[model samples]
Target: MTEYSRKQEALDYHAKPKPGKLAISVTKPFTTYGELSLAYTPGVAEPVKAIRDDPEDAYRYTSKGNLVAVISNGTAVLGLGDTGALASKPVMEGKAVLFKKFADVNVFDIEVDADDPADFIDTVERIAPTFGGINLEDIAAPHCFEIEAALIERLDIPVFHDDQHGTAIIVAAGLINALELQGKTLADARIVCMGAGAAGVASMKLLLEMGAQLDNVFMCDRRGVIHADRDDLSEHKAQFATKTDLRSVDDAIAQADVFIGLSGPDTVSKEQIATMPARPIVFALSNPTPEISPEDARSVRDDLIMATGRSDYPNQINNVLGFPYIFRGALDVRARRINMAMCVAAARAMGELARQPVPNSVLEAHEQREMAFGPDYIVPSPFDPRLIDYIPPAVARAAVDTGVARTEYPSHYPQPVVETDRD
Candidate 1:
């Protein structure tokens, strides 16, 4: 279909049947006056008194344990840049849809119009008690870093910035499998990362935690390479700065084993891909268009394993593969925080899941006869049923092991599947 046609289709999809992508649904019966009284009124005072006596009773009587707030300020709405909070509702709603669809987690998409970081943080903090967790989305960097750190420090429930760690988790998982396929180890791999923004910095950090050497990773922003000698680097970017003579994306990728592009379209040339060592791993993850198209990169070097942020391509490094399941696990254990240990465990779980045999259901959904653990299938599909069973357990185990969990792993967990036939 043409771009215009696709745009109209999207508009129609959201506009039809009540002019939005989501709606509130009643979870309990209200057919009788007795049910109405129980739902809201004199009967509700019982739970109110119980929760008032013990604040922890809120989890038992209310939906707070399963509710996640997908909050955003519209500063960084996907690849669209700062489109304002009102304009970002569609994306936030989409995130809510994913959370509900993937992990059976309930979500309320909140768009805060405040520009000041302090105001945004305060607003979220005031509403923190209502949610089991917070999924911060579309907030720009620098401020995003500060906001997340402050909230994580203050809030008892998990507060995760999906733009940062969600992307990092999926990218790290895919890279693990890709590097293994290329017979390369993270410790020895020479990695060049384009775009030293939220996703780039976070991905590099997670990779380092997973055993990638700092000296071997080079980070580049728009000006050029992020080096130790640079005077204008942000603290987050400075953490990954290398004391090296390489000053450009071209220079940085030369002889490198991995090239991760979170930058704009066509920023990487075929010559740069050619300069990389044999069997390189390239994740040109810029959305809508990548730093280098898979076809363009493949024309230059057929030995490379390629991934992008687009679904049409194989090995798409989508964040849906991370955030929902991660939050599910966090909520299941009543985790105090989604710590580094839990994040690493989620990544490792994702990596291992990709290597297992593909179920017939998943193969049929993708219209494929086979999908072995190889260059094209480095990450599990979002629709993979096993993810619901696999990721949360690993993450919950990590949370318990790390002492971040408030309660023991429940025996009747993973919950019952309420809706099984989802495409």
Candidate 2:
């Protein structure tokens, strides 16, 4: 059976009842009236008074330290893009479960209906008191960019748009590992990015920060290659526009060492893949589809290192590789913000994880579970179980070092247990 069909079947059978995916149960008994008073009423006032006197101690007194809000307007629901808020609940809740399962962070999947960027920002800001951090999910590009910026500016807490930075970080990790395997360097390679949207634009920026030459990088959209001469370019695209004669996606692919396709399915031809430089790296990362099929790309260039966004692929460059651990670290540090250093560090961690000798479990996951790690295996298996232990500490340290953290977080071990609100 196809991997997707198998996965869907599992989901179908598993989701056969009400509250089938998640459950909430009391951890401590509240059977007595005195216990209820301590958990919910008069006795809870002790921690409240302490937190009021020293606000930073809230992380010590309540669940705020480990809770993240996976807030979305449902405007950009994966590849089904702009499906609206109500329709996006499943994906958001799924993200919450991943957050819980991966890092032990409590996630509240909040679906908001305010499509206006300003309204969404205002709503989130007003409700910001509730969450330790805000994870902006599946919002569309351009506007998503603006909303995240506004929220970060307005709130002291970390405000991250997972669609933009999470995908970028994971894709960057793949690129790092892929380039290493190809015996090439980011500084010397020419990159062609198809789809000048959220993930693509952020990926280009992050790559440039990692020493990719701006002039050698070409970013294109539906119209064509985004260049200084392009009449139609948003400020977002304008920043990365190049001064090049290559005005078409076809031209951009020609002579390029890397082709990153965040654009939708079947957009790139096999002929285009054949034209790329020797041993080219192609990340045709489209959801449920790709710009070019891996078989087709490999059919054209045997030396190519190919990846996609699907789990069926050997190297699935999914953001599922980044976000869970990222938030884990941020929350651990009581971070005020997630800055560039944290992202770069996370990417470096992921890239390093890819290069290690594939563990027996990973090899077994492939053989028993139909997944493996190799040339195409440029990342840990999504279910590898080490991401929580590895990636988060790296990011938390980066946040502390960059001075974006409010409470100093521990390294080498988790922080000591503290009394919760119910204590």
Candidate 3:
């Protein structure tokens, strides 16, 4: 479809399906006055008094164990920057839909109109009791860092900014497989990352946590390669700043083993891809259009293992692969917070899944290629049903092991499914 047609179709889809993308549904029986009284009046009051006596009973009596709040401000929404909180509702609702569909997690999409970081932080903190976990979305840079830090510190629930860590987790997963395919290692990989915004900064940090050396990862924003001498760097950007003389994206990518573009379309050229070392991995993950098209990159370096944010390409590093299952695990175990161990476990599980035999369901769903554990299939298809079993368990195990879990490992999970059906 043409761009205009696609836009019109999306608009019609959202509009025709009632008004918005979400609605409330009563979980308990309430068809008669007897049920109504039990649902709201006397029966509800009993649970309320019980919860008052023991706050932990809220999970037993309510949806608090399963509900996640997909909250956002309008800033840095997709490629459409700073559209305002009210305008961000649709995206937030769409996120809620994903959370529900992919992992069976309930969500209330909250759009906070506050522009000041402190105001937004205070607002979310005040409403923290209603959710099992908080999925922060679309709120922009330096402020997003502050907001997430404060919330994670103050709240006992898992507070995550999916824009930062979701992208990072999937990027980490895909990078793991790509590096393995290319006979490279994260420890030795010379990395160049463009876009020092949420995804860029977070991906670099996660990579560091997962064994990538600090000195080897060179990060570049629109202002060029972030180096120690750059006095204009924010705290997050400054964390990744290296003591290197490299000043441009071009300078950073010279002989680099990996290039990750969370920046805009065509930001890097074919010339830049050609300068990279043998069997280089490039994840050009800007939405709709990538920093350099995979076709352009491959035309120069035939050994390129390329991934984009588009499904039309090989190894699309989509955030859907990470967030749903991560949250599923966190909620299942009643984890206090989503820590680096849990994130790494999720990434490792994803990478391991990609190496396993493809199931027929996933093969039929992904028609992009004759699928296998190869360069084109670094990460398993997002539709792979095994993800629900594989990733969440890994995350839960990490949560329990790290002592953040309020409960034991979920009894229903790690229920391994035999995938005998494959092409």
Candidate 4:
């Protein structure tokens, strides 16, 4: 068998056979030729005319209100880094599926292979009219920052880079809940972030916005802690550099109230985790492999509240838990932009949801589940149905109240259809 056919056979047997990864189903069906003419050509002219008369009604008449485009140039495909467009299809498709599963939003994952940033931006901009919002996924940092900023400024619809903002929002939410559970405040906590990459920088910024003391934050890259003296730090890392003379991860780790790892595997030693202050909140958020395994972390520090990007852990600080609901809120309000205020609002909503009494349904999901909210249960499980019903509405209200929303929808959304028939 040919290699392509062999691969296709495996995918067909193990993946596509389970209902195919995606399907383009009709929204409003046109079974008859008369209905087809009405829906496609002749009668569709009336709605087209109305939309032309009032452009805002385009959202009302078309799928634009509920459709989002997951656009990426494949410069950074997850931790697999800089894998180019064709290889990034699976990840983008996964994101599209997540949007559909979580918020009932229809999504098209567009993987573009543009050699130039301008071409990529222009491409997205040209297609902006068809989507309610644009989700920039897995694009590389520095460039992603520039792309997101320019697009948000140019497009009327909300534009978000899920890697930077989404990861930051969810991490901030987890930190908020962890600190609250530990009876600590962000302003007083000594936060040491490992990895001054896009997500770490954004997380630090969110924490700062939420009252974290800048002086107390120690950002570390591969070389160790980021200081003004460090010549190797990225421009994003320089912004978070502290005045402290501490030059290594060990020093920062010894005094830290929180250890946030966005770096690679085995970067954090057990000795450093052990050196953290009593009840230290450690979010080791490296992907398939964390900076320190939860078992090893818990083995070293009895008082540590540990979380990772992995699902098997007690607290999985994944962006999937944040962006779908966040965009749902933004789209609901027809938000023009996603500001720091909206991000803070999302973090607060996530934290508050965790503070509430755990529902029996959620407790049942956990194997060692208990009806309590404490160290082990700092953040709400992603499966918590409250994410859809609560968090997004809070964000929408925040967007509207902050004057960022271009238009506002009704407060009440119909109960979502949890089950879908695979055609």
Which segments of model 1 are wrong by more than 4 Å? 413-423
TM-score for all models, in order of appearance = 0.96, 0.93, 0.96, 0.91
Prediction-by-prediction clash tally? 0, 1, 0, 0
| Model 4 lDDT tens row, 194-278 | 9877788889999999889999999987788788776776678889877888988899999999999988887888888988888
TM-score of 3: 0.96
Give the better candidate number (2 or 4) by TM-score: 2
Which residue segments of model 3 deviate by more than 4 Å? 415-423
**Model 1: per-residue lDDT, tens digit, 57-155?**
988999999999999999999889999999999999999999999999999999999889999999999999999999999999889999999999999
Tell how far residue 280 is off in model 4, in angstroms: 0.9
lDDT (Cα) of model 4: 0.83
Global local distance difference test of model 1: 0.90
**Candidate 2 C-alpha lDDT tens digits along 1-423:** 999999998788557776435666566778999899988889999999999899887888788888889999999898887999988888888888888887887888889998999999999999888889999998987899899999999998898888889989998888877887788888888999998998888899998887789998999898888999887888999998889888888889997999999989999999999989888999999888899999999888999998998888778887778888998888877898999888887887777776556566766766754434457688777777666766887788888889998767675645322212110
Which window of 10 residues has the lowest lDDT sum in candidate 3?
414-423
Candidate 3 residue pairs that clash: none
List clashing residue pairs in candidate 2: 366-371
Return whichever of 1 and 4 wins on TM-score: 1
Best by lDDT: 1
